[model samples]
Target: MEKNYFNLLQLPVVLPIDGSLLSLHYQQLQRQFHPDNYATAPDNEKAAILQQSASINAAYQTLKDPIKAAEYRLSLEGININEEQQTIHDSPFLMEQFMLREQLDDLEHAQNWDELTLFYDEMIERKNQIYAQLLEYINQSHWLMAKQQLYKLRYYAKLIEQIELLQEKQFNL
Candidate 1:
């Protein structure tokens, strides 16, 4: 049986519009539906609990992350995004992704920690700006604009991963 997002989210249909509050609701659902809690239950009950837990986890993971949430919302609108089968029509976003990929490649080969730090700082600033725009777009019901912002968010998320790797290298050396 497919679970409704509202049920998986463990939230009322008319949940608060606050993102932070939604995150808290996701945590609450995690506590309630986590598979560990069903370890001692009957076999049939455990099976049902595990299935529900997986659905809850999938829902929370998508909803708590801005990019995933936007993508999920788009899917609901029948805007499918299969990276292999579907092409993103946003040329500017594609260009930005290419630029970011080049910068990440350059950073990977750079010997100077200062350069990496500078790049990390720039990406963080961009992320914050995008996040602010995301909040505004969401409030204004600009779904397309919010989806565009989410594309930027994905770039920042990858940049964060790169920064973490660089930090680890610095700590080890």
Candidate 2:
């Protein structure tokens, strides 16, 4: 039973997916296949439900995260990302990212929350800009550019995660 994450969530494969509806559908599916509800069922049926429950959970996660959703879409388009080829070939963007990371790494313990917020917002804006281009390229069937955009998004996503972790550490101190 091959299923795209969007299909499993019963939603269209597009940006700005409805989170609330996805949650509702996910919970309903969980309840339907919960092992407690099948205690008296046959052994094979129980195993099947367990597998389905796992698949449903994975699908829910895939559709919940924007970056993951983009990767899922690419997979649907028969684009297998070569995981080993992770670096972006765009030299200028790589330099910008390197500088951004260096700046983040240089943050002091006394870094202002407001300043951190601004930095976070700036990274998010960059990610969003790339995503907009990605959507355009995808719609136009520009496979290479779309894949490049995904790589860009992945970098930003990882950078954002680092910033968030740093923010938590700084704020807690």
Candidate 3:
């Protein structure tokens, strides 16, 4: 069985957690076990704090991201959402992504920021809708649908990352 990150972080097993709560919990754990706080302690104590701090950081990252949290929960439920032999057979979703990529590729040099911002806003709205459906699936204990949405969300996340990199490159020019 997989270890429960929610328990490790002292958080409830729920999607759409309050970001501030996660941050607060992480900060509290960090302050308690940060190596700097054990500077004057023995070497063994420092090593222990370092290990604990690393574990806390891993738990924090898992809890803070909705997708990672979903993945962890699904894994615990005995569902492997791993893409080993799995393929996204959703044709409509793939087509939509293709069209979005087309738009991104066709972006002109002029007015790039405004155009990219509008496209990013559209992507954000769709991503939020995906998240809502993912939460509903989770709340209802529908692991299959949640897994499907999680896959889609991961794809969107990668594309959005590319968009952000493009923006950074343009901004730096």
Measured against the true structure, the TM-scores of the candidates, in listed sequence, are: 0.67, 0.89, 0.85
Q: Rank the candidates by TM-score, best first.
A: 2, 3, 1
Q: Taking the tens digit of each residue's C-alpha lDDT, what string does model 2 give over 69-145? A: 77778888888766686667899999999999887766645476777778899999999999999888887878778
lDDT of 2: 0.84
List the lowest-lDDT window of 10 residues for candidate 1. 9-18
Model 1 compared with the native: what TM-score? 0.67
**Candidate 3 global lDDT:** 0.83
- C-alpha lDDT of all candidate models, in order: 0.71, 0.84, 0.83
- Which candidate ranks first by lDDT, i.e. highest? 2
For model 2, the superposed segments whose C-alpha errors exceed 4 Å read: 109-114
Relative to the true structure, candidate 3 reaches a TM of 0.85
1-173: candidate 1 lDDT, tens digit per residue: 66656556655433223577677877887788777988899999989888877777788777766567666765655555444544446788778778877877777677567787888888888888887887677667776776667666776887788787977888788
Model 2 RMSD, rounded to 1 decimal: 1.9
Per-candidate RMSD vs. true structure? 3.9, 1.9, 2.5
